[model samples]
Target: MSETRKCMVCGQIFKLRAQCPHQRYCSNRDCQRERKAQWQKLKVKSDPDYRENQRRAQTRWSELHPDYWRRYRDMHQAYKERNREQQRVRNSQSRQVAKMDVSVLDSRLCSGLYVLTHAVCGDVAKIGAWIVHLTVISDLPVESLKIAKR
Candidate 1:
């Protein structure tokens, strides 16, 4: 058997296993959490393009599922209610503070196509959605469309 090594995060002596040849952390929960956090920190610091790519991917995913969080909260109403109750308790204990929430609207132009595939209006709805999107895009000035394309 090999000698036990000290954990990098908690300095606790831990045995190495065949599964993980370079196990630097003990089986402690806090040590594992700290190890993961340190690895993520180093990854972000060492890779410059990684953050930008991650942001772009997140934005694309959010655009694809705009109502994902709303649906999740609705499905987990009990969890949402518990969170609201905890927030209310914290607010009651502290003095009221006024806060202004600012959000910037994006200027990029994109259209969503919603088709109701019912028995009567399946093809009609698709054709109508395409026609509407085309009409809206054509209404924009040529310069605006060019800028939007950028």
Candidate 2:
């Protein structure tokens, strides 16, 4: 009978066997790898419409699983912050070649004048002028500039 037929490769076919009619590979590994490669090739050849559909699918999934999306976003943001901090440390170390040390001046000595004195230069007159201008124009009170060493 047609139901009792055998496969050519494995030769152990049973009733209602082989879900895929076109399946030739008998091994599960070969079958899975073949399917994966086919899917990858198809995705690679897909047009903008296919990509839009995928985006819509992801949006629907996020809507359906709001908690999952929120957790994913939080994890992604934390990862980005960690990467940025690491990069900042690395950049600061590299910038030591041309970096100038800044000395914190005592507020009592400068009479409440917050001066950012650079060791490379005796007086940062331009920066001092800008700070003074900001103090006059902005809502920030001039008293806030009391230079306290961290």
Candidate 3:
């Protein structure tokens, strides 16, 4: 006979398997998935070697399939839109990305030296965003930044 225990993930009562006495998650797929996720998170936090290996593996995978994300995004419109929205929030609060309404932020744009970055296609909005407290790399005046007719 095995002792009954509560599942750590779903909080459901389950009996420990006779073979596995230290099982923290039940046989449920979701619970097993959550258990693995929690275990991986802990491993990454505690093991520097594991974290570095995982990063290297991910980099290798990305290099092997550079267009994987692009193809996935193309196949999944909702995913693409969600990522774009999150990116907008990230851009708006580049110092600290958080979930909040951008419209509530200060709308006034101060005239100062700002860094210009190219926006990726279909991701960034038309409104310009630049870093604050920008260091001027050149002695050129701010007015010189404006472009004239070609």
The top-ranked prediction according to TM-score is 3
**Model 3 CA lDDT for position 50:** 100
Better of 1 and 3 by TM-score: 3
Q: Residues 38-113, candidate 2, lDDT per residue (tens digit)?
A: 7766984777777678789989998898798457757799877887899999998775333345444345443333
Report the Cα lDDT for candidate 1.
Answer: 0.68
- Report how far off residue 113 is in candidate 3 (Å): 19
Candidates 1 and 3, the one with greater lDDT: 3
Q: Provide the TM-score for each candidate, comma-separated.
A: 0.40, 0.29, 0.57
Better of 1 and 2 by lDDT: 1
- Please list all clashing residue pairs in model 2, or write none if there are none: none
Q: Provide the lDDT at 106 for model 2.
A: 40
lDDT tens per residue, model 1, 1-150:
865899998787889877889888988999989988888788778887977786799999999999998999999999899989999999886533322342232466444323334243233322223212122335445544444333
lDDT of 1 at 112: 35
Q: Of models 1 and 2, which has the larger TM-score?
A: 1
Clashing pairs in 1: none
Candidate 3's TM-score reads 0.57
Candidate lDDT values, in order:
0.68, 0.57, 0.76
TM-score of model 2 vs. true structure: 0.29
